[model samples]
Target: MPTTPLLSKYPEFGRARVYLFGLTAGCVTGVDFVASSMIGIAGAHIQGGVNAAPEEYLWAITVYAAAAVVANLVLGRIGTRITFRRYVLLSLLVFCTGALLCASANNISELVLARAVQGLGGGGLFAAARIIAQLVSEPNERLPIFVGFGLGSFTLTALAPWVSAELALSLGWRAIFLVQALVTVPLFAMVLTLFPRRREAPTTAQMGTLGWPAALAFGFGALLLLHGIEDFRLARIGLSGGETLALIVGAGLLAFALHWLHRHPDPWLDLRRLGSRRYLVGLGFYSLYYLISGGWNYLMPQFLQGGLGFNFQTTGMVLSLAGVVGLVGVMAHTFNFRRVFRRRRVIVIGFAVFAVAAALMSISAMPGASIAVLMPPMMLQSLTTALIMVQVASMTYLDFEPEDFVHAYQLKNIMREIATALGTGMTSQWLQTDRAIARNDLVGRINTFDLQTLAPELPRTSEVLARLSLQIDQQATLIACDHLFITLAGICIAAAGVVLYQRALA
Candidate 1:
């Protein structure tokens, strides 16, 4: 069937049209923020309330991210066949239903399953929103729409932790899902009514090229990779059996999957686009940006709530400032600083600032440090996130032809999902290992036999010992957080140097 002009179906470009476009942007951006950030805010609840171990808690994030990676790659092509409107509506239904399932989940396993379901819909929302943006705005006029989307998305993300904290505290974590379900209902109605209807039937070629095999292979490979990481972490710490076998198995599977994708005539993802040097470098920077940002977001909540003894509301408020700063940074892009600086320069500056922010965060991880000490670094990190995210994305797609734009978007989304999962997983693994080491070192220093030592001052009662043990655990966690931040800072600084060196070589 012939393609329909999807853009022509909407009302004229005016206030009403802008409002609809804005709503679609908000929905797409909001779902991702809420889904990604909630894992951090609710990390404690999921671990303690659900009795899940640290590694197990990671599944809540990994499963969702992995599902999203697959969905983003597959759904775009599927949209071409089913029509954007029908595909979006179906996705919304799936999203809402998943939220309901999440709200009713009684265990971690159920919650993880529901999250996967939700990710499928969330991925569609992201792709559909981009499609709508493409259809509604001319290329020249699209920048403002993107800025507006960034502002709205970050604003929603900024408020999400506070809202999630309030709900989790007042009504329990399940309320977060309930609220998501309720909010999506009206959005669903709006989408159904306002979105353009499909007029064209899919061609035989479109119907036959679903790429399910590639998507399945990709997802399974990602899962195995994460599972292998988990096993490695456990084995290194002597917490479980060695993961060499799992690692080998996962590498083999991933290799097989890549080979399959390369051989497929119409692959879900066009790997050929990665051949561009600019695209590859930008892709590298983008992945690193998410690696740092995602890990920090996940780790910060644990530090504040678990290590520093902050209440949920207080932690939410503190972290929410980053969102506010992020909004400001997004707005800063409107000034067209790119006119004065090369994209490479802007990227290097962003990463440099990120490194500084990470260093500040490391210093703030000391025991008994005030919340005030953490605020500046957090805000700076958020600012740099907005800067790097927008610029790197623009640079990545800057040279692509119109035909390659879709593939570029797909590849970016896939990298983003994988990067986020790796960030959260790696940070969690590092924290778990570092904390164990710190705790052991602290315990070893206690020297109960030495009457002159600090341990002799404490009473020998079980209550006293328990309290002292808790204090030690808290301090150990703080030290571990410090180590993680310093490592992240080193990574950012090194990345900045690499970017600069690449510019020189170019």
Candidate 2:
């Protein structure tokens, strides 16, 4: 908990101090990696296997995301009322409690309730980290802090799958949550000992309260709308009458939530910041980047393990290689993002590489392909995402007021969370739908009656169709996945255009 001598004695630390600050940022990011990936375990647990319905399992992700959105909005306001140090420590406590609860959960529903608690903590960890970085450093020193946070997130993300797998195997998935709880203790202690508290605005009650009704309504509304969008895609392909009705209801709730937000005096989130040209453009790029990036995160595991049938270790190795490459790329650009690449140019180029990596992923799923053949493309993809993340976030707040940093940072996190939820959720659904349609279509064309009537004769049509079904399903899933990459690419390109327009305005 002791402050580095440099930070205590100097208003702005030197290079060593800055790097240490980055390391601190990374530690905070580690918390996020643990929380974010825990949901995957929750989903896997509920389905009782890896192959559980991707659509049904998606709520594990969406619910966590919904929690984050509420946290970002709510915590941003809460932080304004207290010291950054106190807020972070409190947030960590909430997170640790959630982790412990998740570890002890008896069922998926309990696990999700635990995750909602975890999400509250997880969301605060990210937003609070950004806010703390802003407070600790001078303007010129922020990039290093941002870099440190990025390195931490990417490293944990890269390592988490392998680590989670091991823990899940040896100790059960619950152990992952327990480990997070243990890790937070030292972090919590460090904050209390070192970080000095500061005065802030009035209490929440004095700041014109956002009541529970408005808060829950706003949260549920956003969740339902997002759920509707996710469910709509599934409904288009398959789903019974009940499922379709659920989707419609979700959409309606989302609409009502928006109307409520418009009418309410004390809505939980401040949507006014979203009106800024810079904030909008920045969020646009962030959402696009994550949409593309999230697709890779969600599908790559399936590509590595499900399609190629690589063992867990092998799949982890493949992703680990990409993560290492991404870390190197981020470190290489750490000192000078503005100097090395213009923001607009970096995003465009990054998206181009991401698209290429995504395309190669589809090819990697081709029958009989070795994963080693796909490593180069995956590394390139990781490198691109690494660069884009830091650059865009730093640029997003480039010209904003100091007071606006929390708002901008929270919005950035919200967009990334939602984009990941939507992208991963929708794509997983697409894969399932495509496979089902292919399987049913292949079955329909087979002459089961003729094969039965023929008795001992070779069931040529059935035999061919069985093999054909597997091939068609696999191929269709890959093709649909490939198209998603192209769609993400187009989204990124549009984001680039928005950033360019904002740049012109600047």
Candidate 3:
């Protein structure tokens, strides 16, 4: 039997064992962020020239995200069997291997495959941290630790893109993934040494605990949600037959998945406790609220680049500022969530602020806009999202029975993963389509008559076409971005109402 420490040395962590556990948890968070950053850098570099189609390189992101969905949903049961520490080590190895593969890949397809491999392994990081943090800490003491994990995760994500970009630029794209492998290797070894071994428990549910239906729900739901968003966006530019099929398939799958959860006795989703009413509402609000939040986060960089025409450094600076403000918000809410503000109230306020911030952002994207116009929305939205996330961490578990901790945690985790993926995917897809449609519309409207053929009354058709294309690209981008604000605002409003209703119940 592994010896249990009498007391946690870190107090917050509970003992030497727990502190080491936290370090491992931190690695999990850090590594996942690193994987994402590496891929982002690779994608950015590949898409650097205008001649490259941004969509072609985006496979790196989509494939990784798909892997995360599949792994996150399936790995819960795996943890029951393998033990969290062993799982962490295995996940790290897989991630490192994928990084190495990505580093060596010569074409976009190879890079995407490598990214998928990394995502498959990297999926365990966040879920495992949630479980381990719970396992290592006293029930009352878990929030701060989880918050710390969240902070580390966000901070790494915040800084990583820039760091990876710089590394890729300096050493070439392959080096970005290589750097991830190098950094994680030493930490992985240290973590294995300090972490305690898992105790075998025969009674625990296996990986197939929820059965295939639940698994299908999770996997297909993610695909559907993501694809649905893609379709919606593509609709603006007029969908291709394939894209339209994808949209329909994705929505149908998601709806069926959710329906199965609701109706089936042993449902795919653990919908049993959703009867709590508070949990259901809270979780729902969380999904919708984060959907908007994810969209805003996804769109911010594009806004900076396409609308404001800022360089990477300036974009990083803006993102960094948002991250810092968000960090402060998280800290503020964590300390205040219990004593002063109730969970629902805090979430509602967060949504209200988000709505306002999103609205501000929409206005900032207007034609002939200045950089200063963006600051207010950027700062406010970031801070607002941070506060909501903190409150969500606390509120999600507020009503959870001690025995139901694993189930409750897993449920929320799934919701967040699906929500963010679907939300961001859809937002991006729509933005792309909208931009394309607007460009096409503008191009169609431009007078194309040859000057000589028009009785000397019109400009040369080719020159006019060139000027129109440039104007269309820029103006269309602005217009599409403006529409994102509407989506953001509507989501915020719906979330606010949900939060209010949940607060009343709470």
Candidate 4:
């Protein structure tokens, strides 16, 4: 069959074309962000809907990420082979079909399978969108474009939980899945109309050698690594109190995968050229950001609801407040930012501010603390999120050649997904362990003699004893969280220090 030649030279888009590209970019990123983030927010509801336990339901999220990583590897080739336009269209079809299946799922198995399918398509969509975004603008002009992208995506991220919760409560949990499916229809039409159709591949562009062996090895290695981490966290696969078997095995597999990618001719991922010191620094900062963001995200909800005894609705409201305030601040700062502050300075401040917020929360959180105490720090942390996001986006790929944009984009996002999971998993593991230890230490201090002194409202009775136990549990959880938040503050400081150390991000 005949097709147009591949785009050897990039076009300088006009004002209208720029706006069209921005719109498409927003839709492309927005759908994936909302759907993926919202699915996470509504996980408990979905779990209940499918009658799955916590561990079982988690596979839905895990599988989605793994599938996406695999999809990213494939799409970088497929986009060039089939033309980005056609590949994206087919990806959208796969995404919608998976969404529909997810909505109709009757069991955990069905839902997990659907999520994997959805992730495959979403991964392709994201890689293509990012590459398009990169190609459309020169490096010097990308900050504003990135700020624009961050505004919509982060705003949607902030809203996804509230929206998902509302939908689940009012329209049933299936509404979450339905939104993903329905939203793609208009997006499909928009992409078809707006995306350039002249970039069909010529015969010379084919990936003549399939890298399936290395690709599968990399994918499996990633899954094993994830499973190993999860197993260690759950205390399931450890032996002799040494490094866990799964982890050791996973590490070996990953080493082999990397070796293969390094040595294999026509490897699926030719990553040798992309690993400059500057690029590696960018990747490090990305992991730090994800760790902080994901860890806090996992912790804050529990702190609000469990530690402070706020209801689910109240927790959502507080989070929404933080999101809105952050969005407003980010928008105000975006236009005049270049004039007001240097990128390096802004990145430093972003991490520094998060450290401040974490420290504030570390000290202020208590069983009797009011929302006012939590709101300021939450808002501060949320506001800096956009700062780090915008700065990182504009700078991460500064060293990559135009030809490497597709692979570079995929690698960046792939690391981001992994770091996110690690952040949540590591925090959850520590919190649970610390909470139990705190609870035990607190329990050991309680006795009939100390009960009246600790709480004068309680009498020496079984019912009052139960109340005291509840109070102790609350106090213990808060103690664990307070300790954890302080540790996070130290990490944020280290993150800021790294930003200050790196000179290339500017």
Q: Which candidate is the best by TM-score?
A: 1
Per-residue CA lDDT of model 1 for 157-178, tens digit only, reads 8888888888889998788888
Count: clashes, candidate 3: 7
Candidate 2 lDDT over 263-309, as tens digits, reads 76755455654566666776777787777676667777666555555
Structure candidate 3, residue pairs in collision: 8-14, 8-15, 9-15, 77-207, 214-268, 229-426, 233-430
- Name the candidate, 3 or 4, with the larger lDDT value: 4
Q: Candidate 4 regions off by >4 Å?
A: 1-17, 105-107, 137-148, 206-210, 234-245, 329-341, 449-470
- The per-model lDDT (C-alpha) reads 0.75, 0.67, 0.66, 0.73
- Best-to-worst order by TM-score is 1, 4, 2, 3
TM-score against native, each model: 0.90, 0.83, 0.81, 0.86
List model 3 lDDT by residue over 1-506, tens digit each: 75544335333223554545555576677787567544433345645421235565555666666677667655666666677777778888898898888788777777777877887788667777777677655766555455556566666666665666567567866677788888778868866876555545646334435455655555655654465454464455577788778767767766766676667564323557645666776677767765676667667767776766676666766677666777677656655555754556767777888888878877777656666777777778877755576566656666766545666766776666556656566666777888888888866765635324433665557886575455567778888888888778777778778667654335
Per-residue lDDT for 1-506 in model 4, tens only? 74322222334444455555556766677766666566555655787999987557666766667667777777767777777777778888988998999999999999989988888787667667777666655655555455555565567777766777677888989998998888889878878876766444446644545566666666666766774464354433444434465566657767887887778765556787687777777777877888778778878876876688876667767787788887787677666656655687788898999999999998887868899888889999988866786577656777878877777777877877777666665676677777888899998987766876876875678887787788887888899899889988999898888788788776
TM-score of 1: 0.90
Q: How much does each candidate deviate from the true structure in C-alpha RMSD?
A: 4.1, 4.9, 5.3, 4.8
Give per-residue lDDT, candidate 4, residue 82: 73
Point out the higher-scoring one by lDDT: 2 or 3.
Answer: 2
What would you estimate as the lDDT of candidate 3?
0.66
RMSD of 4: 4.8
